[model samples]
Target chain A: MTEEIIIAGFGGQGVLSLGKILAYSGIMQDQEVSWMPSYGPEMRGGTANVTVILSDDRINSPVLNEFDTAIILNQQSMDKFESMVKPGGLLIYDPNGISHHPERKDIKIATIEGAKEASELNNKKTFNMVIMGAFLKIHPIVLMENVHKGLEKSLPQRHHHMIPLNEKAIKVGMKKVKVIHDYKKLVAEE
Target chain B: MEEVKLMKGNEAMAEAAIRAGVDAYFGYPITPQSEVIEYLMHEEPFKRTGMVVLQAESELAAINMVYGAAACGKKAMTSSSSPGISLKLEGISYMAGAELPCLIANVMRGGPGLGTIQPGQSDYFQAVKGGGHGDYNLIVLAPSTVQEMADFVDLGFDLAFKYRNPVMILSDGAIGQMMEKVILPEQKERLSNEEIIKHYGNWATTGKPESRESNIITSLDLKPELQEIHNQHLQNKFKTAEKNEVRYEQIQCEDADYILVAYGTSARISQKVVQLGREKGLKIGLLRPITLWPFPKKIISELADHAKGFLSVEMSAGQMVEDVLLAVEGKVPVAHFGRMGGMIASPSEVLDAVEKEINKI
Candidate 1:
């Protein structure tokens, strides 16, 4: 399956890091993956969005038109990417901030108060991990073990200590999903 | 034979420099060209084999460092894109005036100013014709593949020392960022510096205490006859460069009626276009110039005999076409297709351009 994910937020909101984790996860799943970001001045401030495309075959184009999934960590990110999300695709947003639901009926909007949950867990910074947890719970793109391996490859050597906390945040965020994509059932028809 | 792995243009260039047994590298980071520094930095080439590496404050500083190393008769190089290269032209001119041997890699980008970070081959004239002010030429090598990108690093240093001229690796974004398979040479084939000094040390400014009377490195000679004679000497060296440095790749030129002249990234895109043209039974082929200065002029001028029309494809606003006109010498009518300020010409667009020429031809 072809999956396109655009993770966007303010520069320090860990948007780039999250996109890297997703890309590494794709690589772990034996998928052809590419990650491109806004560079130069656009990267200094404002919104920093990275487009990641993972496919079973070769990726001809790295640019994304409509994302299959979008993980918006802030209000500005939600405003920037909500309309760009594909119909029936998932929108994982910070529950404490984003308010407007996309008027689209086909797509599922999972606003799981991620920042608040992370904050309640005494760690607001792990909001990215919360979003990733929601992603793991929502999509069967890869198993939790694969995501862990992806994180291991993507994280900096200095940030190895953050791994278990990220895992904990992912599990806590996964708890709120209350939904899982049944890939096995869907595979029967395809 | 060496085993080739898929590698990007920038990675290949750095790899080539390392494999070429480069003794010193002084460079500043710039878009498309930054990865060369990045690869060398992480690979810690200096620590691995006791090579010299310096990340300078500016492109000016970097080129001067290359000059210092090259003056010592050591294989040295610096890499930067267009704007950074413009900053180094002053040093390049000095190096040429002193006749110090060094290598420079220009992974060119779009610019008359700080244009864009995309690929462009507009620096053709600047590199080949000598961007620096002087009656001299730096042997410019244009590579279109990962293999050539690496191979030329060694070749550039060899040619630079052999002719006592600066050698350039004329590469662009396509080769800088794109990944291709390349077979690497056996490390045993590389030369040690003691062997290099054996070749170039005679003219190097090592020291005055033990050797000759004095070692002077300067571009100044106010005397008319003296400077005139120096200019004539440089001209002769350039003539030697012209004779020895012509390198190019020809694809299906024997039977093709139409020719596509491009290099670096534009050349890779042209390869795909040539394949499509051949599939449609259009007699189209590519002539990729591997060396821009010694410019495969003889090869291209000869191909003009069989070619019905020549289309010069570039990433700049039709800069290299002047060189094509020079080479073809009006044997066949020449047309140009290009995009400036970091825009890349797609393969389909190239095919469309070739079709437009075919319609008129």
Candidate 2:
């Protein structure tokens, strides 16, 4: 199986790290993976995006224009990536600070109030973890056990203390995600 | 110990150099490739394997440092981006002329002069044709995957010493910055002074023993006749390398009507184009030139005997296309398609170009 994903948000929103976690998890699963970041001076503060591909076989073209999934964290990313999702693909975004929501009828649209959830957890840094949990809830591409193992592998030893907290934030995201549109059902209704 | 790890291409190259027992690495950081030096610094190869890692005063100093270490028969390397590579050209020429062995990696960015910091393949001509002055050719390796980015470090060093010529790893920002899983090589022991003297004693400038005269390392020859002889020697070495080191990969080319010629990151992208084109009933193939200098001209010429046409896909405005034209020798139409100034073309866009080329045929 192959999953091509794009994770996009503000530079400081942990977008790149979120993709890294997925890539690391893929490695733990003995899968071929590639993470290509849109790197430049803009990575300091501007809109940053990364294309992560995980495949059962060798991966080709790390940089792709279309994605099976788009994890968007900001409105700018939402505006730019909403049209890039493949037909019947999934798009997950944080409702916080988002003035525009995904309106495509040909794909799945889900929301996780990552900002509010992280605020409730009293750690805004866990926002990406929360969003990751929501993505796993919608599509369990990599198992939770692999994720924990991947977190241990990716995060430094000092950050190991926060793994449980991050795990809890992911569970919170899994429980909190609301699917606003299901493309299959929409197509059925049509 | 050998282990699997996910690493960026630059970091993989640096880590591979350490594992390959590189004696020293001197470099000045540049965007898209700074991680090579940064990874080397963080790993502290000196602590791990007695390797020296230094941030030189400038690109010139870094290359000259490589020249010095290589003259002593020590495995040495340096890396930089486009503009910084331009600064090191004179030193690179001197190294080539002196018959010094070293590795130089240009993680290229778009450029005429300090162009965008994003990935680009505009340095194709600079790498394969000869960026440095004088009549010389650096063995150029174009890595498409992070694994190759790691593997080529060892291969580049081997080829450098085998030919006593400077070898270049010509990659773009895309390959340098992207991350993928790599099997870190087994750590090899660095060569000792005694080992250097034993292995390269005849040519190396190791402390001379009473048995031999002092070895001089210089590219200069005041007499034009002697200089011509030296140039001839270099040319013969290059010709030998061309016979032995031309590396490339051909995918689905047995019955393909159209073949896409590309290398490095462009090869990776064109692979997808081949898939998409095949899905649409187009007989597309890909020829990725791993050794860009001793280019796979023979294979292209052979493919030209069967294929309907060829398209050279690069991130530059048609650089490698000239090589394709030379190889095809007008046997079939050859076209160039690319996006310049750090803009990467999409698979669909590239397919469109392929179709246009096929239509023209």
Candidate closest to the true structure, highest lDDT:
2
Candidate 1 lDDT by residue in tens digits, B29-75: 99978988999998888776667778999999999998888777777
List residue ranges in candidate 1 displaced over 4 A.
A1-190, B1-7, B180-194, B209-211
**CAPRI-style grade of the A/B interface in model 2:** high
> What lDDT does each candidate get?
0.78, 0.93
Q: Each candidate's DockQ score against the native complex?
A: 0.08, 0.86
Give the per-residue lDDT digits (tens) of candidate 2, residues B102-154: 99999999988999999999998998888889999999999999999999999
Clash count per candidate: 7, 0
lDDT of 1 at B115: 81
Please give the lDDT score at residue B8 for candidate 2: 97
Give TM-scores for every candidate, taking all chains together and pairing residue i with residue i. Answer: 0.70, 0.99
